[model samples]
Target: MNIFDNDSEVLQIGALTIENGTDSVILSGDVEITKTQAGKAQAQALLDFAQALCAVFDELDSQGLPATADKDPSKVVMVNNPFE
Candidate 1:
């Protein structure tokens, strides 16, 4: 099953543990893929995980809050609270 398909705080697939945080999603653990059928399955799982992440980015872009590759922390601007 696709772990990102639910609202659970934590989800697991094989050897990976995905933690839903307040501002980020944490991924931990290791998945080993050997030269066997089982290994191919594991590789597919990894690809699914990556595709899920891309979906998230696409959703964000659709909402006009696109994710950027900017790595400079100084470029961050604090704006007035919109809820106030």
Candidate 2:
């Protein structure tokens, strides 16, 4: 599978799973190489992309974006709306 973000570039290229009673996620791209070589190269590229994404998430978590906030019971509020 190949995933592209809004920038419209090759963001991730990876192998897809196909099994019984399952639908495959088709990727739109030209598979212009030998199966073995293309699979190896794309797999490596996708791994690199995944690592980069993980780093970004880690950075965001470190910045304290309310993800680590304590669960206070008093912060919970209930609102009732009867309009149907």
Candidate 3:
């Protein structure tokens, strides 16, 4: 059988998707925010997700891939705060 054919195995796997070019972030599955531990875990999970994008492009650059030199896409330095 293929991997993850059992329901119990599926529960242990989580997927996170992030798109640096479009400024998008996603967390896999439903999140429970009632507990402080759960909330912090979810937030940290997202932060780690964004960081993973840098390695992808860095690998491409190491391979001599042509990329725009005008901007540093991996560094998420400033965020637009609407409440400010």
Candidate 4:
């Protein structure tokens, strides 16, 4: 599934998709990740989560899905999050 915006790079997630009103942020590609309670989590939690996510992407890619998700994809940094 993919969502394309003119000039804005397309976001494609294997067979996974995101629609309007999902309360998610497109960090990169077609992966829409939701913010977690990092404040309450351990210091390594975020890193652990990222590793797990990468693993998932790898698995998905092996299953014929693309692994293009990233925290920073050389995208234009938004001055502010519209959702906020």
Candidate 5:
């Protein structure tokens, strides 16, 4: 008999385990499609977040450095709560 026969009432999709019970399909795992429109939007949001983080770090580095015509080798400085 085929696995899709009346007696068989379950299906697996990637990491998901779906059970076709008397009145419902029970999903046992989260499902994600990396190529779907929603997935692409999520990826783009993540990329934007990463770029924002990099920009913050760059700003902190610039703020900590001094603008001088000559480099000084004897100045000792400490930065506190750069984000604040």
Candidate 6:
């Protein structure tokens, strides 16, 4: 399941819990992979999660908005409309 989907707010894969927020994304839980087949699958899922985050970062970069941009809404200053 795509955790980035609009309908998905919380997604749990293996021992990882991902929470999608309005202004942030939260990740909780520990990922411990053993040497068994289940461990391999868990490792793959972790990799996929990392790749997905990378893709989201890339998309944000393409939009001229870096992920590290200041997110303080209170610090935002409204400017006068130039078209007015």
Number of the top-ranking candidate, with lDDT as the measure: 6
Candidates' TM-scores?
Answer: 0.57, 0.40, 0.35, 0.30, 0.37, 0.66
The worst-scoring run of ten residues by lDDT in candidate 1 lies at 1-10
Clashing pairs for predicted structure model 3, backbone only: none
Candidate achieving higher TM-score, 4 or 5: 5
In the range 30-81, model 6's lDDT, one tens digit per residue, is 7788999999988887788788878886876788865474779999899999
| Candidates' C-alpha lDDT | 0.71, 0.48, 0.46, 0.42, 0.54, 0.75
Instruction: For model 1, state the Cα shift of residue 51 in Å.
Output: 0.7
For residues 3-81, what per-residue lDDT tens digits would candidate 5 score against the true structure?
A: 2124456555446565644323355875465898877865665455447546655775687834543546577677798
Worst 10 residues of 5 by lDDT: 1-10
The candidate scoring highest on TM-score is 6
Q: Report the lDDT of model 2 for residue 10.
A: 38
* Clash list (residue pairs), candidate 2: none
Candidate 2: Cα lDDT at 40: 79
What is the per-residue lDDT of model 1 for residues 1-84, given as tens digits with 9 covering 90 to 100? Answer: 333445557756668887765445778997677899988987787788778878876776788863554467898899999899
Superposed model 4: Cα runs more than 4 Å off? 1-41, 66-84
Candidate RMSDs in Å, in order, are: 8.5, 11.2, 13.1, 13.7, 23.8, 9.3
TM-score: model 4 vs. ground truth: 0.30
lDDT of 3 at 7: 27
lDDT of 4 by residue, 1-81 (tens): 122212333223433333322222244333333455443343344355456556755765677864453555577665877
How do these models rank on lDDT, best leading? 6, 1, 5, 2, 3, 4
Model 3 per-residue lDDT tens digits across residues 1-84: 112123222111124322223222233555454457767776776565445545655765698866545467777588799898
Q: Which ten residues in a row have the lowest lDDT in candidate 6?
A: 1-10
